[model samples]
Target: MLKIDDLIIDKEFEELLPVLTPEEFVRLEQSILKDGMLDPIKVWEEPGTGRNIIIDGHNRYRILKKNNISLNYWENYKFMYADELPTRDDVKRWMLEQQLGRRNLSEAEKYEMVQKFKSVFEQKAKKNQSLGGKGSTNLPKVDTRKEMAKATGVSEGTYRKMDVVMKSDNEDLKQKLREKKVSVDAAYKEVKSTDQKPITVKQQIDRLDKRINDIDKTIESLQVEKEEIIQRRTSIFYALDIKCPVKYRWDKKGYSNTFPCFWKCQIYIENEEYENIFGEYSVYYNEFPSDCDMEKIPETYRNDFRMIWKKAHDEIKALQDEVDKKSMENAKKQDEILKNAMKLIPTDEDKVILKQFYRVLANTYHPDNKKTGNAEMMKHLNDLKAVWGI
Candidate 1:
C-alpha cells in the first residue's frame, strides 16, 4: 500500500549509485513505457521513523513517477523491503557492497567503493570495541588491504597504487583513471616524479647571496648613469649663458612665502630690429610653470632648453625610483640570508671547518687586495661570522 510520495530518498545511499548517462536514462524510460512495472522498488523501513527509504531502483522509480503511474491502479506494482539492515551504517555497507558487486563498474569505481567499504568496516570495529558488547566477538579480525585487494580482483601492489591515485590532488589523473585512459602504474609514477625534493639551508643561503649581489650591481650602475645625466644638464645651462632660478616652493595659503631674489635673463625678438620682448623672467629647474609665454623667445633656443630640461628631470626621477626598488629587494634578501644562516648549529668539528672557510673568504675579498677585493663581500662574511658567534 506504499505511495510514490511516501518513499524517502537518502542522499548518502543515493550517492553510492553511479549517475546514469542521458542516453541510458532515456533508454530505460522507453523500456519501462513499452512494458509495465516489471521490477519492484527496493526500500528499507527506518526503525523509529517508520518511513520507507528507497535503497535501489531509483531510475525505475523516476520513470514510474514521471508517467504518473499510481501504485494502487497498477496490479503489478510492488515494493521489496530490506529488513536486515537495522542501522544507517549497515545500510551504507550494504549499498557499497552492492555497487562493488556489479560487473560493469570500472577499476576506478571499484577502487573507490573498496575504500568506502574499508572506512565502514573500521568504523564498525571501533564502535564494537567502544560498546564492549558480546557482538564484538563475532566481528572477525580482517587484514583490510589483502581482503579488499582479493575482492577487487587486483594484486596488492596495484591496489596500493590505486589508493595513491584516490588520495592525490590531481583531478585530471583521477579522471583519466576513471575513463581507463591511463593505467594505475603510469599515474602513480607521474605523481612521484613531479614531487619536489626539499631544499637544504646552505643552498638557500647561496641563492639569497647571489640575488643581493645582483641588486647591488644594478643600483651602482643606475647611480653612475644619474650622475652623467646631471652633468649633461648643467653643461647645457652654462653654454646658453642663462641664469636659472636657484630654488622653487609652493605655498598653500597664497604667495605669502618669499620667492628667492634671483637674477633673470631676457629674450630678444627679431623684427627689423632686436627688441626685448620677454623683459626678464626666472627659469626654475623643474618647476617652470606650463602657462609661461614661450613665443617671445627665439624658436631654436627655446625648443633646445625645454627638451633638455624635461629629459634630465624625467630621467633622474626614473633612476631614483629604480634605485629605491633595488634597495628594498636587497634588504629582503639580506634578511632571508641571515634567517637561513641562523638555522645552522655548528658542532665542534663544524666550527673548526667554518673558521678555515671564513679565513679563505676574508683573504679573497679583503678591501686592501685591489684585483679580487670586494668590500661588500667582505662585510657579508663578517656579518655571518658574528651571527654564528664564531
Candidate 2:
C-alpha cells in the first residue's frame, strides 16, 4: 500500500471530470487533515500512456483537488502494467476475503471499500487508455449481439438479427417483438431487407424513413397493450380507505342508523396481548369501514386481498430490481454522455444547464434521502440528470 502523502498527481489527471459532490470533497479533505488517509491508493503504470492508473481512492482524489491540495502528499504503489489491475471477478473475490474477515469490519464498510476499490481500478484503466500508451490490450470485445448468442447458445447470425429487431427504433417492430406477437427473427429479417440500400444517401434516408414509420405504428399499438397491463396491475394492487357520511338522511332516525354502508378502511398494525396473561401479538383491522362482517367474509375475498398484497409486493420488488439494473445502465450511459458532451466543448449555456441538472439530481438522489424512499429508484434519478445534461 502506498502512503497518501507520497502520491503524485499526474498531469493526465486533469482529464478526469469532477463527479464527486463538493460536500464529499470537503469531508474527505477533513478526514485527510485529521485522522489522515488510512488506505493507500493503488495505481498501475501504463508504459504507452505515460501515466499511472488509479486503483483506489477516487473520492479522496477529487476532494484533494477541490481544496487545491496537491497530490504530492501521496505515493503511488505502481503495477508494471495496466493489465495487472484486478478484474470484476477479482474484486468479487477480494470482497469475499473481506467478508471472511467480517469479525473486524462491518459489512457495510467492507462493501463500501470494495466498491471504492473497483471504482478506482476502473477510473485508472480509463485514464491510462485515454492518456497515452497502450494499456490492457487484450480486453475482450463486447458486442452484445455476439455475447448474447454465445451465452444463450444461439447461432450468431440469428442473434445478430435479433439484436437489430430489439433495437429497431421502429415502434411497430418493437411492439410486435415485445408482445411476442410476431416472430423476432422474421421481423428482423424483414426490417433488414427493407433497409438494405443502394449505397446512396437518398436511398438510405428513404429506407430509414419507411422503417421508422412502420416502427411508429408498431409502437403505438404496443403502447395500448402496455397501458392495459398497467391498469390490470393497478386494479390488482388497489387498496381503498373510506370514512364518510351518507347523503340521504332521515329526520327521525340518527345519522349512523339512516344509511349503514361499509366504506373502505385504513389498515393499521398493532401489537397487543391476546389475553391478560398471554404475550403480545400483532393484528390487522379495517379502521375506517367500522362494520366489516369478519365472520361472513369469504376466503376468496380474503385471498383476493392477500393476492393483491402479494402482487403489489412482487411488482414493487420487480420494479425495484429493474431500478437497480437501470441505474448501472444509466451510470454507464451518463458516463458516455459526459464524454460526448465534453467533445462538444460545451459553451457557457450548456455548462449552466449541465450544472443545474447535476445539482438537482445530487440533492434528489443523495444517499441520505434514498434510505427513506426506494434506493434503487432514487439512484436512477441521478442517472437521469446525467443523461439530460450533467
Q: List candidate 2 stretches off by more than 4 Å.
A: 1-18, 53-55, 65-390
The 0-to-1 C-alpha lDDT of every candidate, in the order given, reads 0.65, 0.46
lDDT of 1 by residue, 1-390 (tens): 778898788755675577899999999889878976676667778654476888877888888888997665234344434468866667767777677775577788788766645655666555666565655576565566777776677998999988887766567999999889999999999877644555578756775876686576556544643653554444344345443422212222332212222323233332333222333444333434244555533454575445544544454445456666777899999999998887776777887888999999998999988898999999999998986568
Q: How much does each candidate deviate from the true structure in C-alpha RMSD?
A: 32.9, 39.7
Q: Could you tell me every candidate's TM-score relative to the true structure?
A: 0.44, 0.21
State which candidate has the highest lDDT.
1
Pairs of colliding residues, candidate 1: none
CA error at residue 95 for candidate 1, angstroms:
1.8
Cα RMSD of predicted structure 2: 39.7
